[model samples]
Target: MPTKPTREQWLRHVLSSATLTDAIKVTATELFLEMRANLHVSVPRALLARRLGRSERQVSRRIQVLKESGFLDVIETGWKGRTAVYVGMFKSRGSDAQRVTVSSTLCEAPKRHPLEKPVPVVAGHRVTPWASRHITIGHLRHGVCRNVSTDADASMLEHVPSLDGHAWRSRTAARLTFSARSAWPLLRDTHARLAAHLHLRLRPVAAHHSTAARKRTTP
Candidate 1:
C-alpha cells in the first residue's frame, strides 16, 4: 500500500499554490495534521475560528475554498448538534510524478498584477494622488507630513509615530485594493489617522532644514 503524505509534505504543496493565502494554508494544514490516520477531521467551525482569530463565517468560507480546490472533501456538514467531518485528499509525496504535478500546477497559477500600477482606480476617473499610477514608499511617507514641497525634503514636522514603514505601506495598499470604488475616501481617512498627534519632530536639527525653506518668488 502507498504511504500517505506527511502534514509537512502536504503543506509545501499548498503553500506553493497561489489559490490560498498564508493564513488559510496554515489553518487547512493544521486541520489535516490534527486528524487521525483515517483522514477524518471532526472539528467545529467555532473552535477553528477562535483558534485562528477569525469569524466563524470566515472559517467556513476558507473551508469552502479548500473544498473547491480539491484538497478537502466534506464527508458530512455540521448542522444542529453536530460537528463537520472532512477528509484530506492531499496525495502522497516522495515520488517524481508528484513533484512534476505540483510544479506544473504552481506554474499555471494566475499571475497577480504588480501593485505599482493603478489597479485600484476605477474607470473614467480623473487621476489624483490616490488614483496615481504608482504609489511609492515616498508617497506614503509624504502623506504623513502636512507641508507641501517641490523636492523630496522634510519641510514639515514628522507627524507619524515610529513604526515599521514598509508594513504600514503594505497595509495601506491592501486596504485600498479592496475598496476600489472608494479609494480616495479610504486613502484620505488612512492618511488623516496615520498623521494624527502632529506635535513630534524626532529627527536631528539638520534634517529640519527644509522646514526653513521659503517659496521662491520672481524678481
Candidate 2:
C-alpha cells in the first residue's frame, strides 16, 4: 500500500535526487520553495547563483537537477527583441486542499499524475522512476507534478482529441491537463486548494507567442 507523506517527506521527494544528489539540488529546492512562497519571476541564473552562494555553473546544474526531480523547471523560452525571456517554474498553490503534508519515505515511488495513468515521460523528461533516467519537474506538471507522459498532448487528450499537439488548440484549459483525478484523491484535494490560493496548479497556463496573435485566431 502507498504511504502517507509528511511535510519533510514531500520536501525531500522534491529535493534529493540521483543526478543532483548533493548540496546544489538541496539548496535549489530551498530556493524554489522560497521563490514559490514569495512569487519571484525569472531573475536569471547568475542572480540566483549569487543569492544561493554558488557558482553560475553550479546553479545551472542544480536547476537541471531540480527540473529532473520535479521541483522546478522552465515553462517558456522566448526572445523579446534580441533578449530572451524564460518563464521560471515555481509551484504555486492552487487551492487550500491542494497542498498535502510530506511523508518520511521520500524515495518511495511517486504516485502517478492524478489525471494520467502511468506515462514514461512528459514534456521533455522521463516520468518513470524505474526508467534509469531523470527528468525535470517542469516536465511533470508546472509546479506540482503528480505524473508525466512522453506526450503532454496525448496525456491532455485522454477525454478527447488533442488537435495534433498544435499548441494553439492545446492551449485551452492548459492547467486542467493534469487535474484532480482518481490517482490521489486526498492529495488532489490538497492540491486544488493549494492551487486556488497560489494561483498555479501544476504549472501556469501555456504562454502565447504573441498576445495579439492569440486574439487574431480561434484557439
Candidate 3:
C-alpha cells in the first residue's frame, strides 16, 4: 500500500493552491498547526484566533472562505456551551472516486485576476486611484504647479481654470464659503500668478543669455 500523506504534506498542498488569499492561508496554517499539535482535526475558531493574534470575527471570516473553497468542512456546528468541530478536506481520500472529484474541483477553482487583488492598506486607511486623482486635480485647481512635469499636466492647469461659469461657480461654492462673484476673480488671479511663475521658472537660462547677446550685437 502507498504511504499515507502526512498532515504537513496536506498543508503544503492547500497552501500552494492559488484560490486562497494571504489572510485565509495564514488562518489555514494556524488551524493545521493546531491539528498537528493536538493530533486531531477539530480546531476551534476561538483557539485559532488566539493563536493567529487576530480577532474571532476575522478568524471566522477566513474559516468561512476556506470552507467555501472546499479546503475545510464543518464536522459539527458549535452551539451554546459547545465548540464546533472542523475537518480539513483532501487530507486522505478513502477511495479513487473521492480523490478524483476533489482534485478536479480544486483544480477548477476560479483564479483571481491581478487587478482584482486587494491593495495594501496604509496607516489603517486605503488610498484608491480615484482619491489620488481627485487630490491631484485639487492641487492643480489651487495654484500649486510644482508637480506639473509634463505638457499634459501644464495643459490641465489651463483647462481647469477655463471651466464653464456654472461648473466653476458650483465647484467654487462647494470648496469655499465665498460667493461665486468673489471666488471667480480670486481663482482667475491665482491662475494668472501660477502661469507667470511657470513661465519664469521654465524659461531656459541659455535663452536669456542668447537674448542678451543678441541685444548687445544689435547695439
- Write out the backbone clash pairs for model 1: none
lDDT for each residue of candidate 3 in 165-208, tens digit (9 for 90 to 100): 34554554454334366455555555555455445644675477
Per-prediction TM-score, please? 0.38, 0.27, 0.38
How many clashing pairs per prediction, in order? 0, 40, 0
Runs in model 3 lying further than 4 Å from the true structure: 36-40, 91-219
lDDT of predicted model 1: 0.59
Model 3 lDDT at residue 104:
46
What lDDT is obtained when candidate 3 is compared to the true structure?
Answer: 0.58
Candidate 2: what lDDT? 0.44
When 2 and 3 are scored with TM-score, the better candidate is 3
Give lDDT per model, in order: 0.59, 0.44, 0.58
Model 3 residue 170 lDDT score: 54
